[model samples]
Target: MKRAAKYIIGVMSGTSLDGIDIAYVKFNQTAANDFQILNAITIPYGKEWKSALKEGFHLSGEKLVKLDADYGIYLGKTILKFIKENNIEKVDLIASHGHTIFHNPTENYTFQIGNGPQITAITNIKTICNFRVQDVALGGQGAPLVPVGDELLFSEYDYCLNLGGFSNISFKENNQRIAFDICPVNIVLNHYVAALNLEYDNKGAMASEGNIEINLLNKLNSLSFYDEAKPKSLGYEFVSETIFPIIDKFNLSINDILRTFVEHIALQISKKIESNSEKTMLVTGGGAFNTFLMERLQSHTKTPLIIPDENIINFKEALVFALLGFLKDEGKINCLKSVTGASKDHSSGVVYEVESSKFPFSR
Candidate 1:
């Protein structure tokens, strides 16, 4: 008989650089298609780590290698603390999304740091990390990996839209799962807000106060990425190289920039949430908490937006990475070719096992 696995810890760091979200999930395969999210938590990144990660784009060679190893060590220690604090006893494995540094699938390269060996070495627990490299190597976008989770775990909604550093949406179309990045969200929003000495624009209050710059809004809305086809994704590099320069050219006030950019985000997202027979959309991520952005989305679309409990809103990505790990462990297809434009559907993640006396660890 095949025994069921019960517990796992999933870790994720979004491009927004908001924080590292660690979710302690209890997954049970009740039936062929049903699963449950038992419990979860998201730990905000400290100022020091946040700054270091923000600067990761400029790092290269030895500096990047050292940062990767250091970040891996930090992740291992953090997982240990989370395990002890939660009194979680039956953990099957630790699954991490790591921090994405470079993701240009066009060049056949994508990197997410946080070494699996270091994690297992520190926590003495089986670990699964680096979920994206293989998919990208297979010529996929190496992104929007959460669609598999969205399809299996939250299929109840007509559309699953995640408002993270970048906004991405997934849904069923012609009996196939379709998804793509909508536009930059917190990645650009936070950049400008940080200049005001704020970590984030709480509830988008600052944006709500600022007046929209019509010309800037028009220029932003005209970005070419918006018209791109599905199986696409976005990264920090796009924002730093493309978005920042456009926004900087205006020399506008921070408030005006925030307001106009918020509109741009809302407009881009609204275009993707196409009206359909099914009217309900499930929305999650840090941007979901942005009242102004949400209002803008709601204003433009007739579809009803459903925001679930705080746990689901804040830690859905972390929870889904847990599902990804579970699927990988089961040898089930966790990465979808339809979503990532991979050559084929595949199981992903490099696994590391802890050294244990009773249950021998696998290399």
Candidate 2:
């Protein structure tokens, strides 16, 4: 018989390329949100893998297919190493939100590498992945999926905002969950910081030193995407085709660019944080550590912004993907209509499993 509680490993790779976030979680089947995070870690990508994934967008169709298979194998080996290092022995399932290579929901196509079958074949465990495709097929943004976890696992918060590569917010409005990307965050900031040979703006110190360029700031704030209604999402293409070009036109110092962009981000996000009397915002992800950005964000709204612990800040998405897999395993809805603009609420993700004797993964 199947067990009520499950020990599962959830994996996620965000656009920031910060690394693969791995969370070993235990879910109590009898009660929702009754879960324990036994262990968590981020496996930084080597330059080789990073370059392969980054340059993959321009690859030929044949090469892209090969890269997909290769990435699946890479993910499997990495996960095996994580298991061995953590001394985790009893994983009931694996949920992998493979790195998104392409996402254009308007055209109804979104792809994430790391094959589910390959993951199961290597690990010899049941696996669930490709969580976004089904939602896109049903006419949805196929993003901000973590809101399902927010609704069930973190209902106490008035708003759940994640500041990853991009800033996205989720909250209950009229009893329906609504969420959308606010603006580009580290995806833009880190891009500029890399010019200085730095991984990030530690505590937003560099940005705090520069003066905001009003002209550039106004240009960023005037982007057409900001006025668009919800049920939308952003991709790396937006940054390349729209955001960077606008910023590059103004030949300003890197610090000035970061400073202006931070203001633009704060202003855009703050506009969404209605000056409520009792509501609070739970902020997480890498951007939460940027003190200067946080201060600017706090200046615009009366809502108390709560910064969670480092574990939650770094691994919350991985944790939520774990929750998504758990719900999918039980045949429950893991995608939301309001959040993803899907036709209807549905259980998303393809499940895979290979018998131990038939495992084809080579050692």
Candidate 3:
């Protein structure tokens, strides 16, 4: 069977609550790792929605269920509006990495709210989502799902590091993809900056202006998470419980806190890559735009950090989620056992269909 091009709308909302990124991408089987981004936009969350989502992690049972469905509806409506605004008439599928509410793979359960059924009903389009549950059920860390994309699409780079809500790195070693969350990035950074009434420290200027608190930096560097082995991840729970309390005890100014944390991040990340023979590291995600952070990172390691243009930096995860969904659609291996510590490599994600749509690639 000859398959035509796959036009997938990839939607993602990271833990940082930065925004909802929706990318209209076209994938061609014949082109091999080639995909075209026809249209893409990031819709920032309003204050109310942002607060609601931030607090969603604490919601229980019925309230949590309601939040899941409501968030799904929100995502669907947002996707529809994006299509309308972009005049996008053709779409094959919608692949959404819904917002993570609870991610404790140690307990063998992870939840990313935004119900797939609601999305299909609202959009009248086939959708793929809930990508992590199955992997966790298989006794895996159920994270760093982007490694499959890094392997299949961006294999040229020696390392693929994403500086989003969390700093996670992916690379190949011994013919297997190795990846894990290095440290908290925008999630921690944005939380402190919010106190200053700014969404983010512009180009790390505030950090550059302040002196690094050595005691705070040393304590941060000695966190248990850094000493743990790979196949691990971080979540909002860890940040709120472990990180916030520790940082608060110092009573340092925001700039000092930011400066010390940035150094901590750079050190933690550099430690992982310092011994590697591979020298080219492709850096993406929101943190890559932080000039001060990048400078500190570069100073820590001699490895050449390659930052692509704004599009790749901002939307790579959304782009990779699209590829993951595409792999699931094709019944191919979308999750790696080595990277995620899963029992086996498997195609992950729940596929939902809208009856009798005009999708030429319908399975």
Candidate 4:
């Protein structure tokens, strides 16, 4: 089964509702760390699709199941279009990080939509997904799975922090890699920006234009989650039940809310950095694009945040999930117990294969 390289499609849709990220990658079959993103894209979710996923948080029973299958089909067809448009001639596998619908590891349950079998059936390529459940089953937090990627590929940096829907960081501490969510970032910021009938706060301009409310800032800084130990994560439930209510009671304008929250995010993240000998903090994900937020973050810490090229910032998680899927296919451990608190380091993901193509175009 050896080959010079493995061509994989890594797909990711975070809780931020940013979009589905597609990364066509090539990996050295013998050296896992050697990789390249041959092509990548972020397919913005249409209005109807976005609204459906937003409402899916409250769905249950058959409604939830239907959304899962529908999303899988959507992903499958989307990948096919990407392949055609790029004139991609070879694809051995697809590694999809399905959108997180619910992630409450304490309750021993976490679900990501986009069924793997449906993807395999539609695309006729081996598909690997459902990456978090096994770790949760092992009494782990089932979160910050990207740390495995950090340990394997980006170990040169002292810290690998991702500011996606929720902000999470990974770094080597003592001898083991440690990681956990710091606070809400784009997820909280985007929610309030929607109030202004906009998709985002371009360059964080609105946040920079307003004032930070001292009272709101203090309350956000004092949330219990900030003081919690490592191996933690945040979900939409935390925002809907905890963050939004706190911000709404103050009844501040979206500008002020964004301003205060931006400061709060910066402060929480600053608290995590200890002036270390190795000072490079690699920042990635959609939040890295927020100019004002980055400025605020710089003011809070001296660790020197390093934001890589746009491709890495936008699609690192998708790239990592691609690595995770590849590791599983290779029968190597992709989930780390140190980062996830799992029972043991293990490869986690369900792989699906198909014998024939039902897709419109044949390979």
Candidate 4's C-alpha runs over 4 A off are 1-3, 30-32, 276-278, 356-363
Clashes of 1: 0
Model 3 alpha-carbon drift over 4 Å, by segment:
275-278, 356-363
lDDT comparing candidate 3 with the true structure? 0.91
Specify the highest-lDDT model's number: 3
Q: Give model 4's TM-score versus the native structure.
A: 0.96
Q: Quote the RMSD, in angstroms, for model 4.
A: 3.5
Q: What is the C-alpha RMSD of each candidate to the true structure, in Å?
A: 2.5, 3.0, 3.2, 3.5
For all predicted structures, in order, the TM-scores are 0.95, 0.96, 0.96, 0.96
lDDT of 1 by residue, 230-270 (tens): 78988888898889999999998898999999999888878
Clashes of 3: 0
Q: Which candidate would rank higher by TM-score, 1 or 3?
A: 3
